[model samples]
Target: MYGGGYVFCEPDVHGQPDDPERLAEFEARIDRGEKIEPQDWMPYEYRRQLIRLIEQHAHSEIMGALPEGAWITRAPGFKRKLALIAKVQDEVGHAQLLYSAAETLGKSRADMVNDLLSGKSKYSNVFNYPAKTWADVTVIGFLIDAAAIVNQVANSKGSYGPYCRALERICYEESFHLKQGYDAFVALATGTKRQREMLQDAINRWYRPIIHFFGPPDNESVHSKQLMRWKVKMASNDEMRNQFLDAYVPKVLELGLTFPDPELRKDPQTGRWHYGDPDWAEFYRVINGDGPCNAERLSARRLAEENGRWIRQAIMNPQQKFTIPFA
Candidate 1:
């Protein structure tokens, strides 16, 4: 379950004007709901934004595995342990698929990894927090994966053909992940007093981060307008977040669970959710790499990179250049 991402300002989010005729043609195709292929001509801004979005998404998938992976050995039973292991594997595989999709826009996986390690790239902000207990793992599995499905399902219909196709498969596989997560969640919600307490506490701690998951409200957010115009972003942050609340809030309520916010409710009149401030300041700070687990997460990844360097070198063919994967 990966949290959502925000792009930094791009040409002020309006984008710098491209060549007039080509821009018209590109936009006309998008207006007709045509998919944009990797080999097709595109504005430099479109390519840059897509690369950043997909590469960061790839990074998030594996990184998102970490918080839950820490609980694998300590899982309550052999069955749960096996499930966590399989889920972790699925998350890593998702990363490989996303990296290949990003590569279509011309960034190498190596370069993407370097940018991540150097702090030039970002992943989901919610993952920078620690998973404090088994209940916390369940919260991440159910709530976070639920949130990811909302975002990913929407993006499955996006204009970038490779990214759209990748998301289609991803969204399909994610159903099992969501089901397993909900299974774990329901088990705890119906368990003994201490188990129930653990679940509630996990929900309390995760509520704000979960609220922060879809990112800040649209007006307070930064993104390229051209991406939305080109269908690269299928929904606004507010739209997706509201959709999550509309669907999942009742599920939580049905389990006698609650979010920390008292103001989190749906408006009958406007058909929108009203949520208290979740502290966008914290969201920005976390995304900028100052969160509780940011350093630890990166340290773990860096350790893996170092430990595997020799194997990479042994397999390297210096004369070979990367060829973009064919669909």
Candidate 2:
């Protein structure tokens, strides 16, 4: 699932002055609710932020696949194995879509990949934690996917036509993934005692990370008001997190499970959820590349890139001609 909304370390804005007439026109266009296209005149910061947001999202999709992809071979049955593989394939497709969308802003896929490899760009921190059991996969697929839907659905309505369009399609496929996850989750919840225990254990381990997934509270986040005005960032981290808890907490409790946060509760008066801080220090540490699986995830990605070098070389070769072969 897509991790939190755009929660990267903010790049230093080397803000350049735009031509006043062009800037006014561009702002007016955005104000009129028009999608920003690549060829359109825009402020440098807008382009920089869009590239950063989209590139991080694209990287997340690929890295997000790693934890779940590792489970395909060990899935409890053939049906689950096939489903996991298909789900993983969908995630890879999402990466391609997001990369293409970001490419419209002038960064190449190679540049983005290099940034990811060099630790200059960050992926969803959720993937930095290990998925220790099959139950963990189910929780990730269900709750994490649900959270992503909330974020993606909001972004789908934002400016930037290509990224919005990509999110629209992504949210559709994620609905199916959620169903698959829910079915698996329910089976475990209602299964033998051991299965139920396993599911609960997974939930306990993942709850903190899930809370962190949405990034820090709005008051603490470095997100800028200008991003919201530009429609680049559709919602605050707190708003999305509250929406997620409102929708999912009841469902989780209904299944006879519990959240790790005892203080988690909805305020009856104001209609907001209250919970303890999800350890922002841990979030920062993980984002800075100190999480349990960060090195492993990056190593795996690097190895895959190395192993696939020949294919990329062949595809880029000028003299190579496309061919169709009969089996």
Candidate 3:
């Protein structure tokens, strides 16, 4: 499950627009609830934005697997280990599904890999943080996975057929992921005092990143207007974040867990949650590759890529090199 909701991009451009007639038809189709297929003509920016959104989603699934995968061997019991292994496997499969979806936009999987490695593309910032304990794994799997569901379920209705379809499948598996995570979490919270403390400590550490999961609010982010209008973004960052808080905060509170932020509460007047600042500066810094475990995570990914390169070379055309078509 992925959590970083902000799609970091350069400032919006008002360059030459797409052919008015074609663009009108494209948007009208979206308005009429028509799904845009791979062969359908689309505006250049539509393709670019979809590629960016889907490619980063694909990368997040892959990178998000690493944290919990690391805990498989260290899980409490054989049953837990088996479950963790299966969950991690599902995540990797989700990545493959997403990459295939993104490939429909004319970016090869190879090109996507290069972009991720070169930092031209990014995964969710939440994955860069270390999972320090078994409790941390449950929080990542339960709360973080829950956050991803909120994001993906909203986007599952987006205009792009392939991405929406991929998210459909991913969301199904993710529900199971969330269930197992909640099971583990409840087990910890209801167990011995030490177990409770461990879970509580994890909750405290994760609360900030949890808020950052949905990125900046509507006013602070520059990504909304066009993409939202096109159905590329089904919900605003604040909308998704509020949805998550409304759904999950009560569950944690019922378990007697506490968020570190005293300012986190519902505004009775507006029915919206108000929260302390999650340090947007820190979120930006982490997304830019300065987080606690960013280097180590990428290093692990690079090692896998480097080691697997020969096998990849063996299976492919000797001289086939992929590049981003639009760029």
For candidate 1, write residues 212-243 as lDDT tens digits. Answer: 98887886333445578888788889999999
Q: Cα lDDT of all candidates, in order? A: 0.87, 0.87, 0.88
Q: Which candidate comes out best when scored by TM-score?
A: 1
Ten-residue stretch with the least lDDT total in model 2: 318-327
What tens digits encode model 2's per-residue C-alpha lDDT throughout 188-260?
9999999999999999999999898888878643456778888888888989999999999998899888988
**Could you tell me how far off, in angstroms, the CA of residue 209 lies in candidate 3 after the best superposition?**
0.6
Model 3 TM-score is: 0.94
TM-score of 2: 0.94
Q: lDDT winner among the candidates?
A: 3
Clash count for each candidate, listed in order shown: 0, 0, 0
Instruction: Give per-residue lDDT, candidate 3, residue 22.
Output: 96
Question: What is the C-alpha lDDT profile of model 3 across 52-168, one tens digit per residue?
Answer: 889899899888988898899899999889889999999989888888888989989988989888777889989888899999999998999999999999989999999889889
Clashing pairs in 1: none
